[model samples]
Target: MAISKPAVPPRIPCQQCPLRPRPSFRDFTEDELDFVASFKVAETPAEPGMAIMVEGERNPSLYTVLSGWGFRYKILEDGRRQILNYVLPGDMIGLQGNVMKEMQHSVEALTRMTLCTFERERFPQLFRSQPTLAFDITWIAAREESMLDEHLLSVGRRSAYERAAYLLAFLDARAQAAVASHTELRQLPLTQQHVADTLGLSLVHTNKTLRKLMDQGLVRWLDRGCEIIDAAGLYRAAEWRPPKEGARPFI
Candidate 1:
């Protein structure tokens, strides 16, 4: 039996999604949209464990996550992989390459990931045509860099419980933004291995850490997703505070 491919959703919804929630079209006149739309194309679907880009490959293009989650990681010479971070909906994966010229780490789908790719060369024209889109894209890249910096702090300075607490707090904020609620949040779709790699913990330690959080009434797991049972407590445990500017800065 031949397997059927999933139908690609029309791009119009991308212009309308609550996540996009900005004046994207205003950045480009109709002429520019029409011109750029011609080059827009559906990408091949990436399976849950597939690598989108290897560490040393030429950066292919800027990727807009149309669906699913992905993460980046760097493997040590001894072959241990330390996951860099997670990319969720409305996130772009290759913006760093815009400056670096090549990928420094591998990016892989953490779920059945769908994306829309814009080539590097076409990006200049696209940005020139849609200044707002360019700004949004730049803002997203800076946000990702800030997140990585925060993750570095968590791994470098936080204890196991603190690390787990920080992950819970972060996900609660992200899910509330992306999926609509923190209390109702569940179904994170991330496995223990993913959590371990992401938190820079051994699998055993991650498991223990999660159980401790559950025991402390700080977080709960249900329906394959985690819910913050005590947001204030979790934040305190993680030593988390919204930055003074209300957002972390890229540096």
Candidate 2:
């Protein structure tokens, strides 16, 4: 399916960005903030189930998640789909598309989302004029790569129970970092089908495994989402430790 474009773009000032000034996010210099403000061209809102970007498309813009959730996935020739990663608020999207010729995977919004759009062609200018911002961009890319590597390990070696625990814990940590909130429960806007596709399990198996986690008090299933209940327990169950992260830049 073709991706949908925003009907109307919203104008958001960089100085007033919600992600800025949070303990988990880095503060930009006056000049750097002004540059990013100019760099941003538009803000687009996507509804649930809409494709923000499609596989193999040469899109002209890069995006940063301003709010809400999305997932990246690739479809095989046989029409089997594998989810690669989840995109949360404060995460950058389409960096690969900007650096390469086309997008390697598709990103679909799991909830109502707002994305900040930047011109791809001007990224080089940011690198040339603002070395710090450039470094932050590279840092974001490396962080994404590290997450993918961990996910690979989880899928390849971990048992279904361990994998489910690790995935939930990972998502909870990311949500906490993005929002800088220590709330006991965070909404995960995903279905059992998404969980199944991500973990390479059948829907029935996914449901059964999730029930086990629910019984253990690690997570609670909701009508349209899941709530992370015991993050520490999940970490222990998965034998995983979250990496320490410094302030992250949004753009």
TM agreement with the true structure for every prediction: 0.79, 0.93
lDDT of each: 0.70, 0.88
> Candidate 1 on 1-251: residue-level lDDT in tens?
78977576545433333444432212444444465455455555689889988887787576767668788899999978788887776567777787776788899997897776667877777577767556656777767778889989889998888888888778666655554533454456677677788888899989888999889988776654566778788888887776433331110
Q: What does candidate 2's lDDT look like per residue over 17-90, in tens digits?
A: 98886778887899999999999998999999999999999999989998899999999999899999999988
Clashing residue pairs in candidate 1 are: 187-225
Give me the displacement of residue 215 in model 1, in angstroms.
Answer: 0.6
Q: How many backbone collisions does model 1 have?
A: 1
